[model samples]
Target: MTKGGDEQLVGSSSADTAASSTSDVGLVDETKSKGNTTNSTTDPEVDQPEVKKGEVPRGPGPFFYIGGANGAGLVSVYCRSKGWQRIHDNKREDYKLKWCETKSRETYYNFKEGEQLLYQIPNNKVLTTKIGLLSSLREYERVMNKISTNLNPKHVEIPDPKVAAVMNPLVWVKASEKFSQRILKMEDFFPESFRLDIKDEKEAFFELYKDTQIWICKPTCSNQGRGIFLLKNQAAVKSLQARLQSIEEDPVYKKLPYKAPQARVVQRYIQKPLLLEGKKFDVRSYFLIACTVPYVLFFGHGYVRLTCTRYDATSDDLTAHLTNQYMQKKNPLYSQLKEETVWRMERFNSYVNDKFRQAKGLPKDWVFTVFTKRMQQIMMQCFLAVKSKLECKRGYFDLIGCDFLVDENFKVWLLEMNANPALHTNCAVLQDVIPTVVNETLDLVLEIFNKSLKGQRIVPLQTLCHFVLLHNGGA
Candidate 1:
C-alpha cells in the first residue's frame, strides 16, 4: 500500500498495514484461529516478511454512494446511520470526466508544500452519475444511454411529458378535459364517435362533438392548463386556430414556454365539475413504483391540489383551469395562501380520511375504498403500458397524477397524467408525503444495485473509489 509521506492511518490496527497488500482490506474471517498470527509462514529461501494477524488488508475495490447533491447527502446520512465504511463522495463532474478524458486530469497541489491532500484515496477511478432535468425528447435518449453505460452506479432522472412520450409513446390529456384516456389499444381507445381526418381539405376544426353545447379543444403537447380553449361558438374555434398559428410562428414559441409544432387533439368538454365550497379543483395523487416488475409495489399516499376559483369555462382565470402551485399562489380566492399551507401526499390522505369520515352520509372508507382504488387501477394501467414499451427497469417515477372530476352523476372521469410529478411540501399533504417518497426512492435504488451485483464480483477498488469521490464531493 502506497501512502503519502504525511498520511497517518487513524483507527486502523497494525495488522491492517501489513495485510493491505493482499487486496482484501479490512475483511477478516472471524472464525479463523487466533494462534495463526502471520499470513505467510517462514520460508528461508524467499526471505519474505510474515504478514501479521492484526494488520489491515487492501479491499478488492472502493465503495461509493452516488447520486445528485441532495440525493447523495441523503444516502450519506443513510450509510452513516447503518455504520457502513469505505464511503466516498462525488458529483456530476465525475460523470463529465468519463465522457471527456482528453481534458487535462486535474492535479491538486498545496500552495505552501506542493502536496495533495494526505488522506485522499489514490489510484481510484471515478464513475460519475448526473441527475438533472430531462429537458426534451432528445435528452431522454441521452440520459438513458448514460444510465446504461454506468450500470453500477444508477442514474435517477425526472422526465416531463415529451421525454416520457419518447421513452413510451402514450396519449396525454389536456388539463381542461375531464377524462384523460390512456391508449390501452390504439384502436379500441379512440371513441367510436371520433374519426382521424389526416388530410381533410377543410382545416377549420378537428372536432369531437359529444353534444352541441359541449366541445373541448386540446393541443396535443401543451401542459399546466396552456393551449386549451373551449369552443362555445364557431368564431371561437377560428379564433383559437388563429391564435395557435400565431404562437407557432413566433420564434420564442418555437423554443421554451410553448410546445408547438406538435399537433393538438381536441375532445368534448365536461361542463359540470363537482365543487368543494363552490370552488372547482383536482387532486394530484402521486404514485411511485420501486421496480417495473410484473408485480409492482406502489407508494399509495399522495396529495390533492385544489384550484382556488370556481369552475367557469369562459373565464381565462389562471386558478380556474390550473391546479399548479405557481398559479394557485396568484389566485386571490384562497383566503389563507402561505408557503407552508401546501400539503403533501400523506397529509392529504389523512385529511381525506378525516373529511370523509365527518361527512353526513359518506361511506366509512370512501377515500381508501373508492378514490384510492380507482387511482391505483389507472396508475397500474399507465405503468403497465410504459413498462411494456421501455427496456430498463427499476426506476422511481412520480407516476400518473390522476386528476379526476365527479359529475352530477358522481361518476369519476380520469383526467391527465403528470409523468414528472412535483414533490413540494409547502402544504401539509406534501409535507407528510415526503417520508414515503424518500424511503421508496432509497428502496428502489438498493434493489437495483443488489440485482445488478448478483452474478458479479466486487468491482475493482480503483473504479469504486472513483465512483465514491465523483459521487460524493470529488465531482
Candidate 2:
C-alpha cells in the first residue's frame, strides 16, 4: 500500500493512478472522466482521462487515529492489524503526526492559556475545530464552497454537495417559504433541482415521481441512524416536530444538542432502490482529504451496507429505509444479514453486471462512473467549503464517509454527510477493506505532512489509491 518508497505526498484527490486493487469485489474507482460530460451520457470507462502533476512540500511522522468514539478505535485496531505500531506512551512521540480533538492533552488538548487546553488545543490538537460538527455541514457548506471562488481563478466549483444539500427537500422548502418571492438567477451550466418542501417532497410522489411514496427525515447531526424516520404525510411530519419539541422541552429527554436540538435534514424516499435479493441496500463511499491546505483528495474503493429485511417502504420498517450497518444490525434478521448485508465495491460491481446485465431500466454500465463522479464532486465541494478557511496549522486532515442511493432511474442521490461515520466491522467483509483504507489514508497524511522533508524517498509512486489535487495547500 506504500506509494513506492518515495512516500512523497503530492497534492491529489484527482490522482494519476499510482496503484489500484482490483481483486477486492465491490470496491469501485473514484476517478472523474474529464471531457465535457453529463450524468446521462458519460463513458465512465474513458481510459487515460486527463491527469495532472504538481509537487508540494511534504512532512514526516507516523499517523494514528483520534476521536476514539467515532470509529477511531476501530481504525487503530486496523492499523495494528496491518503491523503498524501504536504510540503507547504519549511523552516520547515527536515529529509524530497525531490527529486529536479538544479532549486531548500534550498529544491534543483542551485550549486554555495556563493549561493549554479546551478551545485553544484544537488550533493545533485537531486541524481546526469547528463550532459546528461535520454533521452541521449543511449550514457551513457555503463557507466551504466560498473557498474555490475566493482562491482559484478557474473558479472550478465542486458542485455535488453544493447541489445535493441545497436541493434537499428541507432546504428548498424552508427557503421558498422564507425567500421564494425573491429570485436568484443562475448560470447556464449549473445543475437543476426543484425548490420544494416537506409537503412538496411528499406530494412529488403521488403527483410527480409516482414511484416514490414516503419521505425520509433525519436529524441534521446524528450517527447510527438514530433520529431517522419515514414520513407518510402532514400528520406524520407534525408528529415528528412534536416529538422533537417534547425532547427539547423535557428535562430527561434533552442533554445538549449537537447542532440545533430539534433541527433535521429531510428528503423524499427513493421508493425504488435496487434490492439485493429481498433486501434494500445503500453504498458508503469514503473520501479522504489527506491534506486540505494543498487540497488533496482520494476517492478510494468503499464498502456497501444493506438492510436485513426485504424492501418495503409501505411496511413502516426503519431497517428497510435505512441501510447503514449500525441500523441494520439491530433487526431480527441481523444473523442471516451478516455476509449478505455488507459488500465490497468489487463484489458489488461483479454482482450488478452478472445479475443486472440485461435488466431493463437499470443504468448498469454507468453506475461506477456516475457514482464516482458524484463522490468526487461532493468531496471537492467539501474541501472547497473549508479549504481556505481550514487552519491546517499542523497537518490536520479528515476522511469523510459519504452515503448515497440510486433511484430506479439510476440517478444517484447524495443522501447524507456523516461528520463522524462509524468504523465498526460487524461483518467479515469490512475486515478486508476498512483497515487497508485506514492504512492508505495514514500514508497519504504522512506524505502530505513530510513531502518537503530532507532525505525522503521521492519517486513517481504507484499504488491502487489515486491522488486528486483539488487545491494546493501551499497556494
Candidate 3:
C-alpha cells in the first residue's frame, strides 16, 4: 500500500481478476452497416476510425464513468472488481479507441484517444467520458445532450451551470474573491465579519471590523487550503503582500502561474474553534443521487481532517490556521501525535455513533438516518429548482462531497457542494466503501435500463392481450 494521502495505492487484485475474466470472453462487434458513400464507418479489424473532422462516434453501450485521471483509475478498479467490462481504455496510443468486447474479440466503438466516448447499451446502459472545456456554451450543450441520450430519459438532464450558480455557487468559486463574497454572505451563519466587494475600498472592510483580532485570506477557487493566509494586523498583511510580490518576481513562479490574480477572498478568523486535543479540523460528508428515482443517499462514512497544531489565529501558526491534508502532513504535530490518536473516518463514525447513542433523546443511527434524510431533502429541492429552471431530464449525479463547518452550537453550515467529487479508494475507509458505492451506482444504471425496456414491452403485451380476448369471445 502506498502512503500518500489522496494518492495512496492499495493493492487490490479483485479488479484485475474481474477485468481478466471479461477479456477472456472476447469482444462482441455490434456495428450497424451504413450503405452510403458519405456515411462511412471504420472497420475495427483493419483500418482504425479516421480522426474525423466532426463528431466522434458513439459507443455501442450506455455505461460510462467520467472522472479525473486519478478517479478513472479508482473507477476502473471498482468496475473490474465487479467483473464488468470497461469499454474505454485511456492507455491506448491510437487516436481511434474502441470498447473491447470479450465475447467476440472486437471493438464496438471507435473514437480519438482522450476524446469522450458517448456510450449507450441498447436497453441496458450508457456512459460517457468527462471532457474539459474552456467555458463554451456550445460545448456545455453538447455534453448535456450526450449525458441525456446516454441515460435515455428526458427529465434526467445535465445540470445547467447557470442554474447551479443560484443553487450552489461553490462550483464556480475559482478564486479567493468569490470565496470571500460567499463567506460574507454567510454573516447570518457566522457572527464574524464577512465583508465583500472591497477591492477598491479595502478600508471599508477594515473600518467595519477594526476590532477583530484575526482574519484569514483565501483564494476563491482553490481547494485543499492553497493560497490561504492568516493575518493579525495591518503589518502582517503588508508583510504578506511583500512576500507575494517577491514570489511574483521569482523566475520559476513567473514561468508557471495562475491565469487570474483577483480571485482571492478574506474571512474573519474563528477564535474558539471546537477541537480534539487542541488540533483544528473539519468534516467532509459524501452524498449521492440516483437521477431515475431522484433519491439521495449518504455514505455512513467520512473522515475528520485535523491540522497538526493546536488552535491559533496567528499568521505564524500555519498548521493551526489551515485544516488541510497538505498542511497537516508538513506540521510536526502529525508526527508527534500518537498513532492510535491519528484522524481516521471510521473512528469519527464510531465517535458520532457513541455520542448519539449516549444522548438521552437522540434516535439510534440518528446521524446516518436524520442527516441523510435532510441531505436528500436539500438535494431534491436543488434538483427540482434546477429542473424547473433548465428544462432538463435523465441526468444523474452519482456522487458529491458536501463540506461542513460545525460551530460551538453543533449546527452544520453547508460550506460547498463538490459536483465532481474525487473518488479515490486508496484510503482504508474509502477502500471498504468504494466497491459498494460503485456497485450501487452501476445497479441504478441497470435498473433504469430495465425499466425503460419493461415500459416498451408493456404496451405491445397489453395490446396483444386485448386482441386475443376479443377474438376468443367472438369465437
Q: Give per-model TM-scores.
A: 0.49, 0.59, 0.50
lDDT, candidate 3, equals 0.38
Residue lDDT tens for model 3, 279-325? 66666555444322222223324456666656665548676766644
- 27-60: candidate 1 lDDT, tens digit per residue: 2321111111122212111212322234432343
List the candidate numbers ranked by TM-score, top first.
2, 3, 1
Q: Write the per-residue lDDT of candidate 2 for residues 228-282, one digit (tens) a residue.
A: 6777766775676566556567765455432225344455567787777767787
lDDT of 1 at 381: 48
Error of 3 at 440 (Å): 3.1
In model 1, where is the ten-residue run with the lowest total lDDT?
125-134
- Candidate lDDT values, in order: 0.36, 0.47, 0.38
Clashes of 2: 55
Worst 10 residues of 3 by lDDT: 125-134
User: What is model 1's C-alpha RMSD?
Assistant: 21.9
